[model samples]
Target: MRLIKVDHIINFKLLGHGDDPLDTKKCHIDLNALRAREDAAIRRAEIEAERIGAGVTTEAQSIFDALSKTLPVRWESTVIVVLNEVRVSSPYKPENVVGGAGAANERVKKVLELERKRMQHGRQ
Candidate 1:
């Protein structure tokens, strides 16, 4: 991938060796641009890792993933919101789930219990 700086925007182009004879012969590579891109990517990865490590347990994340399959899920600080109505707080137990319509609340509780059992049994 070749990164081109055009004004303030960065553009990427995929070039194959020997595809463009003239361009290949010229062989004008931007080492600075490549280095900048690499540095930016590394910084982004570090930031993402830090965000994921911020008190979100694997159990809580797994529960959120499962619930998101059939419902709208979002994070409210350390809490997981389901269907925009139900809130599942940390320690993510059935009892920790609160505030939702009747059916949605029941579904969230069932998911929490099922996830808990799955984790306890070490099942994927």
Candidate 2:
């Protein structure tokens, strides 16, 4: 097997040199990007709290709200990291997995739309 190293723009680093596609390897994480994500989550949560007239003054609550967004697609960047790994490790190369790289993005969009309709109808 050939060693493959990937340096993702989103700060994901994967170094795999094995035969098994599913075999995991050490991943180098970017502290700066992680911190930025945390900061963004908190900021968005605060904005949502204000919009919904909810009192979310603590960092913990803010982070929680941000993780559970009304439109989860806003957090889809995190999901992309996993999909990228799958693509990189796969033996067969297809133009795209599941109809294209935007498959997850489209799925997230559909989920958000469904959530909106559910909320509008006062359904869970």
lDDT winner among the candidates?
1
lDDT (10s digit) by residue, model 2, range 26-113: 4567999999999999999986644331233333233223324532311122221122222211111122223325765454345434
| Candidate 1 per-residue C-alpha lDDT over 2-90 given as tens digits, one digit per residue, 9 for 90 to 100 | 77567866675778556666677778889999999999999999855533424788877788777777787877788888888899988
Model 2: how far is 69 from its true place, Å?
Answer: 18
- Please identify model 2 stretches exceeding 4 Å from their true place: 1-25, 54-124
TM-score of model 1 vs. true structure: 0.57
* Alpha-carbon shift of residue 88 in model 1 (angstroms): 0.7
